[model samples]
Target: MLGFIDSADSHLMSTRSCGACSLHSSHRHALEEIRKVPISKRQILCLIALAYGNFCVAACVSLQAPFFPAECDNKGVSSQVYGLIFGIYELVILTASPIFGKMFAYVSPNFFLESGLFLAGITTVLFGILDRIADSLQFTVLAFSLRIFEGAGAAAFLTSCYTIMPLEFPDHISFLFALLETFFGLGLIVGPTVGGALFEVGGYITPFAVLGTCMILGSLVSIILLPKSGGVTQSKSPSVFAFLCDIGTLLDVLTIAGCLNLIGFNAATLEHHLRQFNLSPTKIGSIFIITGSVYALTNPLWGKLGEYKFDARWMSILGTAINIVGLLFMGPADFLPIEPQLWLVIVSLIIVGIGMAAKQVSAYIACLNDTINRRGYPNETSTYALVSATNFSSCSAGAFLGPSVGGYLLGTIGYRASTQVILGFEILTLILLVLYKLCGS
Candidate 1:
């Protein structure tokens, strides 16, 4: 499912051992790393600053849902038309990812960031204006045009952040990634909660205006705080296909990396599907926050786990298996004749949340190990963009397909049967893990 890691090369870590490898490896690694590499407090702040900026933009993405309803209603717009506009926004980005990813090697990232923000602001203001008018195909088209600009803008910003972190902070890499994800968790927690409040307090335009100002502000912050990235100045590289066709030591790195990405996305799909059960958005958000917060809290442990001899694949399988079992229990606890106890649902969510945390940490650490073993330093730029793109695309496909799949399973077979689908997928993942071991042997 993940395109960057060449699947064929992931087969080499055959003689694995030490599931009990020390858990303090990340802490130890960081301290020893300090002896070799030193940096000021200001540098660390800059990295956090980049992470903070990225999450602010991402949080605003979901804010549109709450904002759109009021804006559309004020203009006498039907919900269906607004829904269409929102759905089409994904399509625009879907088309743009490959085009941007391919040409990414040649483009100047800073220029890309500036251009994206400029278009985003212009288009977003137009969106607010469109909200004040009656429905017209003309307005619909204009709205979509703006969303495309925003997508391009957001994508560039995200990828650039990935590129920048490796350059700015090289020593404390594991902790750095963990902190990045922690901020991502915070954004998920804060976005809807804050967005919901913004919509309630000030009309629809208030949130958009707020988001526009933040995006502009983030751009300014990025310009001042992030030094020019320390990676290759620019690659006059050949097209992406040629790069893909040529491979050497990096192949194994790519292989495990792809596996890591595939599992991550598949897990995200499960999360989205779990929330689709007629739950209130607040409840859904609550569940995510619980999962995200706890996951962020305990997840740094895997940095130590990654340094061990055990292949990260098994950790993924184990975590996925736990996740599936939790879903199995959670689904039936919701729909089966057994009296619905809220505790069961809560417990189930906690279980799945921990499972997701382990899965993400293991997969990424394995990818990091591979990256470090090869590059002498992590290729944070390439790894971040490739993994994010791969995992997100996979999860997007699954999430888009999940409703219909689950609906059919739930509607025709029943809720119990629908939940069993996760059961089957988890089993498949385990089998794949075994297959990976055998192939490596």
Candidate 2:
């Protein structure tokens, strides 16, 4: 997987006479590189199948946010218990993703991909079944177990997808990563909308049933359509321990992950805060759509930018700065002296989305570049696996922490103050970025 880095070829921004011309030239160069890579018809089919599978996996990850709380209340579940049920999925992912990532060293990627989908499908069905059971310790335990099971599946599916892309499209790593994330973002955008609509029409069970069936179909596609294996050798793989302990790389993970935590922090509270205005569910949901749409739409653009114009570190830092401005505008809309317009919130969310897309894509590229530089090649499975796992793990940690921390602050001090938590985190990240840049210079 290790390819020689051509310094002139790798730095896309240096290729042209002017800024706009540079962007266009780099884009054309990217297209030309992609065109040079000859992917077989079967490879195309498999990539599509994997993409679809990732979509379903992402949808399942988010489907419960809208309906689960109401259902838990109806079943007499406590707020703490409900929150636990909600967070446990990510908690499981945080712990399990690394293990699954490492397993790719010994197991076939196809095996993990197919088996994970099947397990996720089964667990989704089980989660729906929990809806029928009387609320009790048994019910709560079963629910937690099912969510953990699904999380394991999610971890496996994502690890496999992330690993496959770099291996399969080694020449177009940034573009392919961006493309895959676009699908993932699309699923997240649609999941709540579709799940809520299904819940309204067919009750609590329908969304999981429909989405779970999709997973089963994805599993079949993985088994039948995708290749069985493109084996990565293990003899020269990096120690997972060493990779985790490296301070420089670990700092990158912390910086990106910490910024992501703030994004999650604001997002987790968006619907709740919007409802303070007595807005209709449809109106509130539309706000989410705007944010998600922006994230989905700009993901590929950011990917292209990282691949062409600048080093991903610069992108990540700039992304963090932009996100801070957006986050400041987001919450305590009620606290503003003027009556808050919906337009303001919408614009803020869009900005947030753009910043998130930049950070997430660039961070991944930065990590991959760092890994390649350290290892003298990009083909090291354990190195990629560890990096990928750390990415997912940190994101999951943020997802879990965001709601808990944000909700706690909201309850204790009120909405305006709750946002300060996010502000503090982002400010800290900005300072770190500046310090790192100065020190590197």
Candidate 3:
């Protein structure tokens, strides 16, 4: 279990321990001092900006869900092509995150945060007008290009925000992280509803145009309210490769990827599945809300558990188990001898949402703690940036893989069999996690 750290060069470990001891002492002192004071006005303003940013980015990501596939179908594009377009955003994010992570020391987080919001907002507005291109090929190309740029902007925004949070509130890292995620969850909850309603009112362009303008305005406000420093101090940071080399850390990262894969799978295919109900866009969007609502409500509980020093591995294991059960019912499996029902889908989504929140929160905390504690990485902005990049990249990878794979499978084998394939992947992840725990003992 500790083999990765144990196998490192003894000399290097001794050097790292000395450096880390001093860093940890200083870090702890700073946090203790911060706790003694009331939350500063600056911190409050920063939190508001960060929370709003999270909300906007998430809303943009999910906003397309209710209408995108049908719109693509109308344009003569196939499910496979549209799925790849969706996956491409995460692909870009995965590629861009490590590059931004390495630059954290040289650049101010405020620059990344504000610029990212602006870029994403602009691209979103551009995307709104893509329907004007009547040619199928042109529409596809523009869609892909805009999504790619938007993904890069999202990557920068997320990475910088992650780094900023730990620096600003080291004492409440997990809680604050969870709190921001709650806002993200809220964005997910709201995106489809608003998008569906706006799409009904003004067709394809309205949701993007309206939401994109809000993001642009939000960026301008963030520039004014966010602190100039971003709490970054120049320091040597460990490479992203260093974190990947550790077995424990790698496992936690894999857990994040697997969990997100399930999410991406649903995002890509669930709208199609619900077509059988012949629901309106607004109702379809409301169905999408079930999972996000559960996730938003449950995230704080998981974060509080992490803040109180609960065993994260156990939380992960339990979450995985719950997720598997949800998936089993989600498909009603080929073996269950039951037909799909609206109530069943809702129940399964609620369960999956709870499980996802638990896994996500615990995995992040586990990765961060394992790096700083067991691996002896320093508690500083550089380390925070690297960790943020690694985890977000994992999520991007899963998000990319899930839709690309799920779409192909959905087109080829249909929804029921496709869900079973996802179930198999989750089972594999569960087995690996259990084996790791048992072997470590």
Say which candidate scores most in TM-score: 3
Displacement of the residue 259 alpha carbon in candidate 1, Å: 12
Residue-level lDDT tens digits of model 1 in 1-441:
111111111211111111223322444444555567787876866775667565665565545543453455456544445544554444444555555554546665555554555455555545656655565666667776777676666656655555556556666554565456555556656655565566566755666677667667766776676555422354233233432342221232233333323232222223334434555444444554555455555554543454455467666666677776676676553445764344665677677666765665555444444433533432334443443444444333433234334433443555555556656665666666557656752
* Candidate 2 lDDT by residue in tens digits, 168-233: 666665445545655676677677778767777787888889999998899998888887675454
Off by over 4 Å in 1: 1-27, 31-49, 64-107, 117-147, 170-175, 203-205, 228-284, 302-311, 333-335, 338-345, 365-424, 435-441
Q: Write the per-residue lDDT of candidate 3 for residues 38-90, one digit (tens) a residue.
A: 67888899999998988898888889888888878788877788888888988
TM-score of each: 0.64, 0.79, 0.84
Q: In candidate 2, residue 100 scores what lDDT?
A: 75
**How much is the lDDT of residue 402 in candidate 3?**
82
Candidate closer to the true structure by lDDT (higher is better), 1 or 2: 2
- Pairs that collide in candidate 1 are 5-254
Candidate order by decreasing lDDT: 3, 2, 1
Q: What is the lDDT of residue 298 in candidate 2?
A: 78
The best-first sequence of candidates by TM-score reads: 3, 2, 1
Candidate 2 residues lying further than 4 Å off, grouped into runs, are 1-30, 76-81, 129-139, 164-175, 230-232, 239-250, 266-268, 278-283, 300-314, 333-342, 365-389, 410-415
